[model samples]
Target chain A: MSTEQQTIDPLTPVLSADWGEKRSWTRAVYETGGGYDALRRALRDMTPEQVLTEVKESGLRGRGGAGFPTGMKWGFIPQENPNPKYLVVNADESEPGTCKDTPLMMASPHLLVEGVILAAYAINAHHAFIYVRGEILHVVRRLQQAVAEAYEAGYLGADILGSGYDLEIVVHAGAGAYICGEETALLDSLEGRRGQPRLRPPFPAVAGLYASPTVINNVESIASVPGIVRHGAEWFASMGTEKSKGYVLYSLSGHVREPGQFEAPLGITLRELIDMAGGIREGHELKFWTPGGSSTPILTAEHLDVPLDYEAVGAAGSMLGTRALQVFDETTSVVRAVLRWTEFYKHESCGKCTPCREGTWWLVQTLKRLEAGQGEEGDIEKLVDLCDNILGRSFCALGDGATSPITSAIQHFREEFEAGMHTPAWELFPYRASTVFAPEVTPA
Target chain B: MTQQSTGTPPISAEVRAELVEIGARYPQARSGLLPMLHLVQSVQGRVTAEGIEACAEVLGLSTAEVSGVATFYTMYKRRPVGDYHVGVCTNTLCAVMGGDEIFERLKDHLDVGNDETTEHVDGLKDITLEHVECNAACDYAPVVMVNWEFMDHQTPESAVQLVDDLRQGNEVRSTRGPRICTFRQAERVLAGFPDGLADEGPSAGIPSLNGLQLAQLNGWGPPPGRAGSDADRAEAVADQGRAAAQATAEDGQEGAVATEASPAGTKHEDAPGTGGEAK
Candidate 1:
């Protein structure tokens, strides 16, 4: 059951390179390691269109959950508009079981800043914004310091490296709202409105910030650009599958040994990832793991061989969302784990759209009942029905994403749920009755 | 053709002096609005019509101009709040972690539903408790915001203890919610457990509920002050027209140039489209 410690073969190493060093935020260390070289190469050898074309050729999908092709999204901007285009890096990584972005910002923010400059140049945006979640004050301070360092090093601000491509990068801390993780919602939040989803179609590429064409990229997506620019498109593309090209950060958590962010090729299997992370904790057999954050479906041990690629995972009925693989061992009950996640979705539902707001509530209610040993025969169907109602009906993907784990968990662990039907949870654990019923309640 | 002014009147001398004094402290004049609103909100308990008018007057803008900015955000309340404004997090994470329990406890304690505030315990009758949507502290699920400050990781014991602390006028520090529970059997039970709980018992199956269905069941609705700018101003202009009509009716004088506002979603030249993202 225990996975042995194995040396992981690291792929592309842009984000995690300087993470181990102290004061990695300083411009000196960043420049010494060939940082901002992409800016120089981009400004000197290429035009905005050329950089866009290069990225498009490189086949970089968004490192954000959506996994949209980054260059195709960039190409959507209308060239005729004279309005100032904006580059916004969505640092609002609030997904449960997803905790890679903030750590990146804390350890190595210069990569993000450099990525912002390169992306801003490619998109012809004069102003770039990094919309960070406000809850992480330390991360914000680190980023702010990194931005100051970047500005001082002349990587940011007007006329950077005398390329006449003047760019100003602003590090904005969003009053923490998970709905802000949605692109339009992030924009609305940036505009000082309540962080709620706006109708997309006029996606940020068309009528973004101040009605100008805006390019909103994920922190890892933008951060990945610097690496792609430095390392040729072929080098970046050679690591992964044809459709999902490049190395991604796989965040292995839960019962896994050495649980942390492991950068690997896209097509890496869960078994390989589990092996790389030193397998589950001793004596614990792998039960389930979320391929992405909790938003994606739960991939059980039976699916351990499934490639962690966009299409491959989808073929197996899950997404390679954010590459957040939260591993769980046998000690974890699928019912309890799903109930916890369902509760999270219900709590984070912005209440803007109907399906997510209401569906999440019902999901939580059902999960709570099932977890509390009060589940009915019809409860599983009801849970699935509620998830069905939420999946496509809600305003944003958050609603759909919320249902992935619930349905998938039920599909895998119907027995755990069935076990709870006739037994009351209090009787099963009489010694811990204080955890559920009141201490004053007399034993029957 | 139009008799009414589109913008607020030019800054008066007295107002200009205060604005200059306030504006000096901030790196930008716009940043001054934060403090200016704070001053105004403190001077008048809540943002009153006259208070908004005075802010507009002081800032050299129309009433709609100031109200537009204020109402667009949640912090500024259009209606009066109870002494203690209890804003609850009813999002999915909190919901699963017993948000309803905390909500019901507060409702029963305060004797009010979502938007209703009880009259003060002593001389302070301004205390209103609202079960608002997610306040974005999911790590600390089942959170409540008591007047802009967040109280996280609330169980029934924690929530009741929080309210008790608040009632005793003790300031609570923002903390993370309970660690991921061991299981339903091992987790801490919230205080004041009520009957008719939907998430438990024979009905304890995952419902085929969607966002819209959940919203309806849980009293979720669109946020207040969603009326777009043009519609709001038009409504105000229409109010002005009605006022003028009433005056004419009273004075026996014929009215000219109704100056009534058009319906909403119409564009205004002076107010730049507050679109895209917030600064």
Candidate 2:
């Protein structure tokens, strides 16, 4: 058998524990591995306020698309309120190229479960919910089983470990709407309304589920808690950059030698990650990649050395969303791929707001034309115009996320799109376009 | 051709009493129409022709009255969709991603198209296909909604696999919402089963570059008899571009993408030159 060589780094694959062990979902196995030992330490020694302060000092940010400060968001919840407060974990990893959350939830669910309980304790919330996307039922089942084990072992449910802090965890599934992936929209969905985004300011922390204080966070963000509690704040902070601290799961996918999740420091570059993943697939040159999910802009080979962090990627006009590195090879058509993505946003537009609803539709139309080699001179500009409408105007980040790929594709590979316009896609791929656009040629 | 009456009309004593109590919960009587329609559908299994008429009468409207609202959204059905409603998005986004291939696959599987339903199994039809606009999961384009439960990142292969799994009574993995393992018709399905055809006037035209080009040069709204003059076609394209730009401008971002690119949505010269990234 032919084996590929992979380079090693500090941020790459240190957590090589057996993923297929039996009863891996159990609290006992978790405790044996120094899990929820964090919870014991957190609940026994640290005050709830201290937990918040330590987490803030650690400088942990939300792992979901929006990199909001996790500690600050937790701090936003009213401490004095008597109403029911909640900790809802956004496990809806629907963004294209975002494969980090599911792996974490699948392989190490206890991490997230422990994080949720610890978080609920920190915020003094009696109840917590994990709003997982509906698709991954296995992960859902695993989480449900994990929570059951936690409750049975006194890690969750009333009077955990005799601390008198009662915490109940509910794992809820969302109807497949990307808008629900948005924090506020996820809250609206959890409340059983059509999943449209509500106006923020009364964020989930202030007025969430049933208008009670809520701390909505990503699964990865919550999962990091147990590690932070066990390792201490400074230990966690010492690993990464000065501003963007701690280790993150870098999910390397597509056209890579070893496409898998790598836990690394924040400022690691794509070149480093690729080296860890055994570099790009042999014989194929890397063309472009998404820094996070498809919702963030695509970066080309020129950016392979760009540091993978919140601030550096932000400086480059792309987000470090979920750290989902989807590397594509040279054979991939940027225009064709972007056209496919734009079509997705158009179809998924909730139609609640005008900019996203209509703008997405127009974007699909233009992108479809461009992909088919029918794009006129103004098509690229039209796409930019349409993306402009969607970026800031739409009710939620769903709209903004939809435009990321389109603008980025145009930014990096404008000529590929222009070439398509001059020659029909049929001529480029001949038999390929003929079969694809067969129905378009048929009479109604 | 006539305006239908508004408000709940006189119904049978039993149905009227039930609807009145249900209607009382909402501040606006019209909001009750959904739940009331649910009531009608449950009582009749499917929203029957008579049941629709009764709902209109109970709501104090004509048959066309309930039909209009029933067909406007995708939730209510005028005719019986298959036990499972397969609403495939054949719009531009999914279309470019080979959404039409799903239509062919479904037609082959169910032996039906948008206008037809397949042979029934276990008191329900195998499948039916309807083209819908964006289903809101663009990340997974070429999406399919099986009974309002989204199945994202779909391909012709995936669609075929899904149909087979549904046929074999295998548990389908639902992406969001309740995980209904079996094929059961939704209580409230929108009218025109596949397309909202029962509505007045025409539906949104499928815009294409070839059609747009022809419309720009020879003048036409869409196709065949719908063709307009070249000037009219150009005007319409311009208007669509302007409307898009105006909407963009209103959103506070510079409408630079639309305006700067084409200015008036004029077809740029099909020159072999690189396009600029709009952002």
Candidate 3:
């Protein structure tokens, strides 16, 4: 095991450094490990502009799939805006393969709390909100407890650390909605409205969170700030490739010996991560994997060594979205996998726009037929046609993302989908006969 | 709030106070809508019409608007739910890892299908089962969530037994944290109240801490040749320098503190008291 570990490169642990410690979530443990030291440095030493400059120099891109520059995002807030500004942390991590944020908050909420303070200070916001998913009550409790500790310890509240900067942090819980992960949709949900994407001429930076200039950042992005501020910008910039700087929390789940969040520098390949994860479950060979989340196009074993950075992944015909690396072995059926992802998109399509709402529904019907081996001739072409219509025509990325697996599976595994067309899914993989489509079987 | 025949009465004084408190946290009262819906679900087992009406009254919105928001979110059930809501995550990853089998097993064991409720199964009453989308705990694939708390790495046999335990009224606890509470108790916690059990046990599991442990055991620090040879040393020096500057800044701002001091407790004034420890 140790020999296999040495095969993978030794990567730095940034956001995940303190995650393993006992009681890492507590304020005492966090502070003892230099938790809020960065916030103190930013508040006492650097001006807001300097802090902004440091982040920009760090070249840290958003970890929430978009890959937008984090510093540039903070800089988008108009400094001279008369209305009060807000900073909203997007903790509603609902992407199919994404699981980093929940664990981060559950294990170390103070890291995020300290980062929120620094981010609010850098962006000159008085109020910050962490909109977490409501289903994870334990995480919400941990965050609320961490916030309460921050207040009692003077990390939050008026005159934080006696720096004369007053900032309030609210830990808000989001009821279940995948669409809310989208920034504009998240803002709408935060404002107590349906979680649907809004028109984006005036983005969230200009008009968000009750018509205030709000900077909505992903939890990983914000949590990365404290380390950047604590260590110099050059320190962060030193890691990763030239363009995509710093480490990211790469969530590896499914069909792996050790499935969890691996905090590696950007541009590491799936081959390396898989090695670190003790390779695929014993005896199974890698068949296919999602480079990011299910939203990103699926990559086969052929693309194992492809660098997982935004530009590289884009060049490879997928986005580096949320770093949700879901691995599947040869035993897994591609058609069944695509069908499950499509069903998720169908269920979560928010019904906001014509293309996503209507397109996802139709796509699911076709995929369901394909998976059940009832697909007629021309079903594959029909699937592609549906994807083409929804890709760019949808109101939001949800529609486009819903098409990723369908289109990508056909690209890589057309034979699997075709095999299912004639033979029932259970027949193709007899092992799943008792489970996959068993619910639809009527009782005698 | 208008009275209704939805079985639940108009919002109680305690619920009204909680709603008002949640509303104050947001700049716009209506922004408190989701938490208010959670509050309603906490008391009514689901978002009843009466609960929606009370939320509308508190947020100064119409019942139609409140209902729309409540219906939009999957967590806000429109009808009464079972005491335990067993949500099997049949997302792509979990489904491939026996989630489908587990879902089928639970349906058979509880005699319920997706989003359907069964009455008086064994000793359990109103056990609602749903094939939930990804619950975001895919690391523990084949995951089942009861009352929104994780039951990680479940097999068909284990999942069936889980429902049986609940049906038999056994003290079923989550893989993490204290003993699993009822669905309503979980709802109240989701509604922004802490159950005070969050501190009882380890919040994370072995899977969660796997990466950090591996990194340490392998002697893997930051990526090489960047961020200085020693990331810890650089951060320590920076911390000490900043700590010195902070001390000087605090000493200099002694008089300014008086002028800049906003009212105490104003920061979290709008935060909910559901957990009672938030304050």
Candidate with best TM-score: 3
Query: CAPRI band of model 1?
Result: incorrect
Please write out the lDDT profile of model 2 over residues A1-444, one tens digit for every residue: 101231212531212121222233445544544566678877787889888887887788888867788999999998888888888899877776665676456545787888998898889998787877654444555576677778888988788898989987766655356666788877766653556788987777889887889999998888877666665565456656768877777766555655556667688899877876667756657888888877899898888778898988988889999887777766456776676667767766677899998988888888778767788888888888888878998888888988999888888888877876776544553322312222333223
Rank the models by lDDT, top first.
3, 2, 1
lDDT (Cα, tens digit) per residue for candidate 3, span A1-444: 011222223566767766544456778767765678778778888899988888999998998999999999999998898989899999999999999998899878998999899999999999999999987878888899999999999989999999999999988999999999999999999999999999987888888888889999999999998888876676677668768888888889988889988888789999988988888776667898998899999998888888988889888888899999999877678888888898888889989888888888888888888878899899999999999999999889999999999899999999988887788766676545323222333324
lDDT of each: 0.61, 0.62, 0.80
Model 3, span B143-236: residue lDDT tens: 9998888898898988888888887778887775557777777777777777777664453676776676566555666532222223343233
The CA lDDT at A124 in model 2 is: 91
Candidate 2's docking class is incorrect
Top candidate, metric lDDT: 3
10 residues in a row with least lDDT, candidate 2 chain B? B199-208
The candidate, 2 or 3, that scores higher on DockQ is: 3
Which of 1 and 2 is ahead in TM-score?
2
Where is model 1 chain A poorest over a 10-residue stretch in terms of lDDT? A429-438
Error of 1 at A324 (Å): 1.2
Off by over 4 Å in 3: A1-9, A431-444, B1-10, B121-126, B223-279
